[model samples]
Target chain A: MFWNKEIETLSRKKLEELQIDRLKKTVKKVYDKVPFYKNKFMETGIKPQDIQSLKDVTKLPFTTNDDLRANFPDGLVAVPKGQIIRLHTSSGTTGKPKALFFSKKDVDVAADQMARCLIMSGMTSEDILQNMMTYGLFTGALVMHYGAEKVGCLVIPAGPGNSERQISLMQDFGTTTLHITPSYALYLADIMESMGIDPIKDLKLKRAFVGSEPYTEETRKKIEALYDIDVYNSYGLSEMNGPGVGFECGEKHGMHLWEDNYLVEIIDPQTLLPVKEEGQVGELVLTSLNREAMPLLRYRTRDITSIIPGKCPCGRTHRRINRITGRSDDMFIIRGVNVFPQQIERILMSTQRVGKNYQIVLDALDDITVRVEISKDMFDGNMEHLVDLQKEITGKLKAEILVTPKVELLEPGSLPSFEGKAKRVIDKRKL
Target chain B: MDAIKQISIFARNNPGQIERITHILAEQKINILAITIASSGEFGVIKFLVDQCEKAYECLKSEGMTVSLNDVLAIKLTDKPGGLYKVAKILRERKVNIDNAYMFVQESRKQGYLMIEVKDINKSMELLKGEKLQYLKKKDCYPRTKKPVKSSQSGK
Candidate 1:
């Protein structure tokens, strides 16, 4: 069975031996059935007999996002559409969403992985899990629901939004665990505070698993302080069978990758070559060890991270990856320097004068200017003081971001509010 | 001495407001020497220094734009390449720097007039004369026959 306890917590040598054994079997399975893998292996001149160990697996051609896009809908499915029990797709905000299929066994393995993640978060079988992720084509809600059920937890299938209803359910049902995005958790905290119920005191939430987007450490700290719950970062992609691919333990240093199910690789995004040293940030490439319906090999995730190869403080035998810094595609270049929106957010949260409601407007000028509108709460007293505050903010932004930003002290609530993901950066500089 | 006048008008932050203001002056053939706009999200204050101030004011207010007239400078420069640069250099030498300045080309006359806000008006005027630069005062730019409308409507 894939969920063997010996395999789950095997020694380093034993784990490698098992991984090679399973990998060899999985390789042969894909090579025989999957046309895509057969063609890929043939093109690379790598025969199934030559792949004796895991190291030889790298000889195969790497799969990319373009490959998924080209083979959209049902191009990559190994089994017929009728045999596939469930279908889910990754959020293709930039382009078309990549479709993922799961057989009954595939679904069970995914659920077990998620259950292992929840168990690491200190969730008990008696705990109630409130899943705030969206249901439907999205796998977050369903995968988490099944995983929590596997752990014998009372599952609340209440999806995203309707904070009042969620609070009511939490109060009524004594919900002890929450599965939500960081932004939604912040929104919940804000709502609870306005309703005169202290979130830390009122909610019986023991742990929160926040994922789905790249959030800064400052944001996690703020959420933790507000709700007084241990916020664990869960990392996964729909293309890789949703939210239980890997999870952070109590140490919170990095998320331990479920190496048994997926072989995680860190490669330089541009070169597509393996990153030699540890702590060097690179794009994540994933290969499913047991995915039968549609197994992806060397699939570039575009998420930039470094691996912590040593044994985790949590005593898990699986390797850990540092919290994702940002994605290569999401990077914005200004004045020849690459900038990520999360970097600006981190700097903004660190500053005392600037609030969360900020818009970085890049105009078509020789000197790139950033107009940051400070929230009204950051401002007190008169105009002169506000100007001083603006100068202070501008100086700090320059020091950290290495660019001078034009700071504007706007009246409280001058910026547009977001109901979902906050649109932080506005790049007006068109190529 | 030719007169120069500064006018401040209240305008909504919608499309065609600028076009309406420009249309009124273009109808009367009044030349706009320089213009500046200070705007928030919803509204803007349009400040203009025009050659024919009184005629421009009557035309603008007649178009229902709330306008007010004030005194400013209209310094003339040669149509040559470095004319504006020489004027700025002279002012910098005299320590009579400009706080704000705007300009436009006169297509028919082949000359450029600069409407500038200086640190000190008297010092700027003295430096202009000292440097042999020609300029127009507020009164000289406007004709006395045209009168502004006296209404209870405050532009603010």
Candidate 2:
């Protein structure tokens, strides 16, 4: 079940040795080529030669999102323009989009790592993968497509949406796997139900790689039951070469983050220091050890998760990290209480009589309103039943988030359907 | 045949929502024989007694509206003051709680139908049978007047 058995199961001592070597090279290259890293190193008074051990990576200046934005286009590129083979940008819904460049070798290495992830997830050459992620400037679709092709699977480049065609392609080609966002997977299940196509009986899908949005384990279980397939949680961002960074093996416990390619760290957001103990909630910080075109050192990912403190039964020496709980930036305050959308998602998905889609609205008066769709089967044509369901959702949310949010029960398709990532929060409160 | 199939739609309690639902039914050529809307907070349930219940359900569902169909007793209401009270008393005497009810008059036939939603349809039907109340069949729920009663006259 391993794409590269030797590298995937590399011993901890050897993995660290390989990591230190790659880290040293990446630091030297970034300092020599990219002025941002050179200026950062000069200001910190840390030389590339100073990074002699893996622990020395802590001395490197952290790369924040603002730093990437301030640098803008090509300021972070380490290699020559001719050597760059591809480029991808972040989904910058707020301001300027951060860009990442890839050289020819960088593309190969990303594909290799993704292949390892897919193989570890039990995909083989015989499987047909229908990649439902958008194949554009975003790195999610293309990188996964390359990885699935590397695994020798017949990849159907079926980009997002056009649900009928996606299902027809699955039926015609006998696709056994899918690379989709968790929200889109749920949305697809809705589409299939309408089309009267039962995924368990009609299609040949055995597993799905769901990522690009922070979702709860409850949502994963819901998708799993809907399709009767194993949903492997994928963890990656465009800055870290899309979705090959971390992947769950067949064990389905936690994602086995590849240590040889990237060094992972968990640090408290407020203190900006490494957490005292493993499994404590902290912001994830990653450094690209093997990337050549854009070697990010101590890049603050701003994703909130913890490094699980045990060995996975999958036997990959590389440690696993829990699913990304929520982005540090996605957390919002209501009535002096911090709430992540995933917390609300967990409550809504686990509770009965609640549907798959929900929206959290923060109005001008600082009141929180949670809009949820009623489960199709739960409606018994009684108005009191709908009222009771709304109150139940409100009670459950209040018990979890400690805010008595006004729950609005909407019809199934009243909320906007997401073709890409589902935008669950709307903060209209005047600051 | 004892119970009439009623389609209920969950919609936002806003202006034009009924217009939208009626438009969708009109587009599908489905006739709304009798209709009632009950609002609860921000949303309301629009229940309909349509000429083609299954077609209406499929069309509304395909239009991506949250809709459901259930069996409810449809009894002919006598055109008198005690007509509603008579059925209410029967239900109260039988201890069958009425969840929802609506009445509409048939302009063409001078007949009226009272739709009643109770917990148990069969039990309520049995209770009304001893009272000699006439239950409307699914076919009887349709509007007797076709072509708006003006278009055909204009053609003549």
Candidate 3:
């Protein structure tokens, strides 16, 4: 019953063969068309023909986020401007956002992988799927929308937010499946209970695909119990053509990453060397084999996760990836918006009243709160003025991160200071 | 006009903050004639009308406490319940804004004294003079007997 039974259940040897073939073509194309990659390869004394087998991939240099940022608008483009059809970006960065371009075929191939993942998440052509992922420059909504259409399901591109209207649409359309983030699922469940309508009774939702942010097992259990349905974790980044990169099947173990289209490697961030052993946490470095417009090689993901050792019960030959524990860097996502504590520090440091020490507390995915200490001299016993300062910091933080955070002003020495690594972010959401 | 010196100290409403300030003043042998506390949330203002206003202001300021002194109107009234009501009604009638004020029981016991900080002290003083109300000077507020405590104050 798999969407693409042959490819989904391909043998490991066959999958590796397919990956190597595509990887060679992608390398040749990038070296010829993109000077950024060409210079990197020339400096490293390697040619496209040097990568004869999958094992030789270790010789290639890694593509880090800094390289992407340095090559701003179209510096990393492999394909001509005439063929590029779409562009998507990550939420927020200090400078320009992470950009990914897709050609016509790249778009179809991404949707095709998404269709396979949809089938794995228990969606059939008979199912009426309601997608609640956000749309626009963030690729979550549009990718899933195209995939659901490709699966021949009755699709409602609901986008995100407006929980009340989402409930109504689910009832009106007899929706059987959903594509939403795990945090939003919890929010919707609470809304359904408040409306006095049981999700299992009033809505026809049988299963859900949750991703775009990391969530805990306890949250997964709560979502499954609240909706009386299966909750599958999906994983992808905009650099990899969004949500189609990997998915959880009926087995509900680690997500089965599709290796036929891309090359995936786990490397120790400090050493930058491959961790071949399974079940060891490391940063995910990926190379796009099938992407035409922007064929990224050894693109460092900065996501810390392990590769599950054994083969899955589901026939997919692709290796499984454990749920992301944290980022290799300080970047964390709140309600789908990527945030860095450095960005917060920069904003607070620029403001006059804010002190040197600040802490970010993410209690839940949606409950993002920042506690900052104000300078003692600024607290001149004026209540109205203090409230004004609080409001000012709140507005500035919201504008910087695109998500409004509850800002609190503490006294001179309330927040803790660390001598070592500075544990400024306390993320209780990932527990 | 001899200005009625009022010292304002800004502090957190923590447990030992006000106690510490008052203890320092007590050790300094400074007479605290009138005091008022207005606080909202974690922080507030502590106003004081003491015998040595400049000394107390410099003392707290040197100790890194946020403190400031403002010249205010010190009105002398009869020691009765209606004394404050008469002063408030007069200021209200004359369109003089009283920012804040506090009254103290004078040593004579027959009369009451109030230190009021208003928007314009000159205008309020003119209005008080027209109403035949007596405004005390700096010398009348603090006594000559209190001048000998500074040597011991600075000795510690």
Best by TM-score: 2
Ranking by lDDT: 2, 3, 1
TM-score of chain B of 3: 0.84
Give, for candidate 2 chain A, the lowest lDDT window spanning 10 residues: A267-276
Tens-digit lDDT track of model 1 for A227-315: 88889987888888889898887788899888988887887665567877875566788888888788887888888777886777667
**Fraction of reference contacts reproduced per prediction?**
0.00, 0.54, 0.12
The candidate that wins on DockQ is: 2
Question: lDDT by residue for model 2 over A1-431, one digit each (tens)?
Answer: 88888998888999999999999899999999999989988998999999999878789999998888998888999988899999899967678999988998889988999999999988889999999999999999999999888999999999999988998999999999988988899998999999999999998989999887777788899999999999999888889888889999988888889999899998866667887788766689999998888889999998888788887887899999988877777777888776778778878878888798999999988899999988776776778888888888888889877899999988887788796567999999854
Q: Give the TM-scores of the predictions, in the order they appear.
A: 0.60, 0.61, 0.58
**What DockQ, on C-alphas, does every prediction get?**
0.02, 0.44, 0.10
lDDT, candidate 3, B38-117, per-residue tens = 77665567888888876786677666566667788877788877988887788788887867777877767888877777
Give the runs in model 3 whose Cα sits over 4 Å from its true position.
A330-431, B1-156
**Candidate models: Cα lDDT each:** 0.75, 0.86, 0.82
Model 2, runs deviating above 4 Å: A330-431, B1-156
In candidate 1, position A70 carries an lDDT of: 81
lDDT of 2: 0.86
